[model samples]
Target chain A: MPYAIEVTDVKKTFSGKQEVRALDGVSFNVEEGTVFGLLGPNGSGKTTAVRILTTILNADSGSALVLGHDVAKQADLVRSLIGLAGQYAAVDENLTGRENLTMVGRLNHLPKSYVAGRAKELLEQFDLADSGNRTLKTYSGGMRRRLDLAAALVARPTVLFLDEPTTGLDPQSRNDMWEVIESLVGEGTTVLLTTQYLEEADRLANTLSVLDHGRVIAEGTPAQLKSDLGATVLEVGLHDNDDVARTASVLNAIGPHAPNISGRVVEVTVDNGPVDAMEALRSLDQAGITPTTFTLREPSLDDAFLALTGHRTEDGDGEDGSAAKGSGGAGDRAGQPESATVPVGGNR
Target chain B: MTTTISIPTVTGAPLATGVGARVRWAISDTLTVTKRNLIAITRIPEALFFSTVQPIMFVLLFRYVFGGAIHPGHGINYVNYLMPGIFVQTVAFGAIQTSIGLAEDLQKGLIERFRALPMARSAVLAGRTTADLCRNVMVVIVMTGVGFLVGYRPTTGVLPYLAGTGLILLFAYALSWGFALIGLSAPNSETAQVMSFPLLFPLTFASSAFVPLADMPSWLRGFATYQPVSVVVTACRSLMLGGPTSHWVVQAVAWTVGLLIVLPPFAVWRYRTRT
Candidate 1:
């Protein structure tokens, strides 16, 4: 099998007071021993896709397969091949750390002798060996998450699904989770990760599908997506808010794409960094718009995502604003600093 | 904390084929899940403590406070009459734990994790009901001890007493299936408790669990006389005290058997279709 997981035009509509199209003809394939990220904001169908692929949910139309087994028809066969660590830590709070892992191991029907030793190994590996005897209620949030991940690994599933694994964790815990996921990839495990974090996808995913409102907006390698945004993100912070339009128009002539103006800041992705920086400064000066700050930097995934989706990843669906709108009127002040932090990498 | 340990790829769950193998696999998975619940109860000693303590409180409240005013008829001692009623009420109430536990699991996303595993789908429901059944047994035994402590005696021999206990446990087990369905449907554990309590309150209170059918208003008497809980309580009373072998035993068995047949299939289906 070339692909460890295959989802083909899967669609699901959740019927309630208002029908939600959780997955709208979504499709993606995950190759063996590589991380495939489904990047989306909340309610963007990242979790819905994971649930269908894990056999916890059935797609209303179309199909999904895990290691060549149909997720709907051959559900048990597919289930045996994949492990899922969901957004919530699913470990029993009343059970000890070791107990939770052992219970999952037994449910997976591993041999009794193997389960005990495997649970011990996993507890130690996840840095919970000393606290293995303590109930999960006594464990910290990060500890619980680590144990949840360890429980998912109990049966050593070939394909793993992590739905927003590091979502609410502290930075240290998130980094630790990243290392664990990286090591799993090193050991030849295929991972399908759903994350809202742009940096996580940029650092981990070999290839990613950027989803917005149940549709794949863009799909590519991080570098490919970044380059597609252009070689440079030219951010010019004007001294006067009145000069926003002039700064954007001047930069428009410098780059192929239009500048995204937020408050006094005008940002545009350009084909060349140093040359564009020099041209932007000279043209802005000619236009009588003296920039308070001029930053010429390589485009990060954040810029790529913004360019593709017309909105930031962290913006909730209801709060989502189009790129053309940028920041206007009363919302401009708050959105100024927010947009300034977007190009966090290669700022010079 | 950033220690990198090698992950060894081990074999996955063994697939069960054929009816016999499937049944075995399901039974094993059920036991495993049941053990997890049981261990949880043991870890939180307050759960077992409160479970036993609640029934004892009910026994004392009825025996001392309500016992003086109420009469169950036939020259029977109030304690004996209340003992059988209390057992029925306790187990019926005990079954609510099924709904609460399952709802907690659902809210916590443990049910999603279980569903994703290769384990049998029925195991989660079966295991939950089974654990609740175990809890009902312990509560019954403790209530029996409290019954004896309060000067209640079973006139019939050990065999009939055992039969009465078996009948009560079976009825509660059947009810657990109904509660399991509620748990799966409820949005959270608190809602599950809220949903099951109203459904159970009338069944236990309106029936002959505490007061005799004749004591109730004329309209309620009809329901109080023949409802499953009243039938079971009456049957238990007859078994514990050597009475005219009325058809209450047959009726109670029939009601419980009917519930066992109907409710489990619904609960299993709910478990399967829930997302």
Candidate 2:
């Protein structure tokens, strides 16, 4: 299939007293009708990349094309083909929900006769029909977001760019947005979503690109990325510091990978975490090493991110990825404030 | 959700193709957005109330309190002499709201929202200036009624009276573009309001909007004489009070045209360059 959107080594730098490189040679392509997820944290160029692709911003070098039209040279054509819901809700506060949607419809060149009707249809679809006549200031945050998304869909765009659409939404609202997006794609709209939440990307994105410091560091399906990191992690904690080396050797021999240690804790990634945990404990038992804790865990997207970027998913700072780096014992202590000996990575 | 209506499942937006059709669509887009803005003005009772009342306040304050002391002399009634200056000044101050509204839109992402649509990009600016123009027209009417109530009369008849009002609106419309640029440049509402006052203070005060050119210091009078607001006020006075209208009309029209030529392109350029 021909690519619906193609970005080729796009570079964008914001020049000022401090020349911040907002995008550094980033590239990706979205297949005609698939969801492409761009995952990154704050200051990681996700917004910059979306701006360039949506033609809200221009890249300093390289090329970006939407539906075969160059974004820089043919911006009008690109604008006609796509819809964008920005990080913030972009509806006019002074206009009523229906008025805002109708105004956007007319702005997009929809027939004057059809605009009001179309606005009504979209409002009902978003479950905002009852509040259609109310001004946006009176709407709750979720209703405003829903209305903003509805406004973007007025033209029935072929490709949609949602830049962190659910960032600040409550759980139910986020799920509603997710379902709306899923329905859009189900009806043949290609979507490119940028997000900081790992669960959002895991649940919604068909393919994922992990970005750090304005560049793509990793790209694959969520399962593929997690599998490449390893199947699961086996965690062990010894009661005494003296038994740490023995526990590490036993775990290192049991798992297919080397054990990573901090203080009296040890952890290793293996193909089967439960089996590996049982083997390591048996070996340690024969070696006369008593561990205070042992457990297995199903690897999460956080684990994939941690393994690939060498940073915990919670630590947004890429330059200091190790700021919140914790050992198996640290994870145990952190997980339960009430007790220190509870097994970390508690899978079963 | 109820599906009692025909929901547009999947389709492309209709483009305004062909040269004539596109030009017509552009005008339509401008008018639609303008109507939206005008509706906002009516809905916000405080905005409408303050806008109408401030000019009334100015007429009363200057008419009752400051009229006798600042007369232009030569047997003209103080109220008649003060009406044109007050009316023109109302439009100028009324134009400031354009910048505040535009800046608020920019801060709230409405400008970015407009940028993404397929409409003619110039329509945003056109709609904004036109809505503000309509608001100024209403202000002119309200203040003129207030002017009549306070015993200000123009012997110059209806033609020039309408012309004087039209000229004030024209100048205010062009000046709106300048404020549009300021609005685009201002990052927030507070800055948008305070930042514009410094630029406007000199334009309105230094010009003969509320006083005569002859009452100024000689050095200040040079600018107070030929500045756009002064030229416009002079044109207005010539039209309504019946004097030599030729030279002032020429300069006033020239100033309005010059502003029209310069500010819109610059404002649109600034709008385009935003990231």
Best by TM-score: 1
Please give, for residues A94-175, the per-residue lDDT of candidate 1 as tens digits: 8999989989998887778889999999999999999999998899989999999999999988999998999889999999
Q: Which pairs of residues clash in candidate 1, taking residues 3 or more apart in a chain or in different chains?
A: none
**Model 1 TM-score?**
0.91
Local distance difference test values of all predictions, in order? 0.84, 0.80
What is the iRMS for every candidate structure? 4.8, 4.8
lDDT tens readout by residue for model 2, B85-204: 887888888778888988988878788778877777778888989999998888888889889999989879899988998999999999999998888888677898898999888988
Q: Which digits, one per residue and each the tens of the lDDT, describe model 1 over residues B134-203? A: 9889889989999999999999999998999999999999999999999999978999999998989989
Q: Pick the candidate with the highest DockQ.
A: 1
Predicted model with the maximum lDDT: 1
Q: In candidate 1 chain B, where is summed lDDT lowest over 10 consecutive residues?
A: B1-10
Spell out the clash pairs found in candidate 2: none
Candidate 2's iRMSD: 4.8
**How is the predicted docking of candidate 1 categorized under the CAPRI scheme?**
acceptable
Candidate 2 regions with alpha-carbon error over 4 angstroms: A230-304, A312-348, B1-10
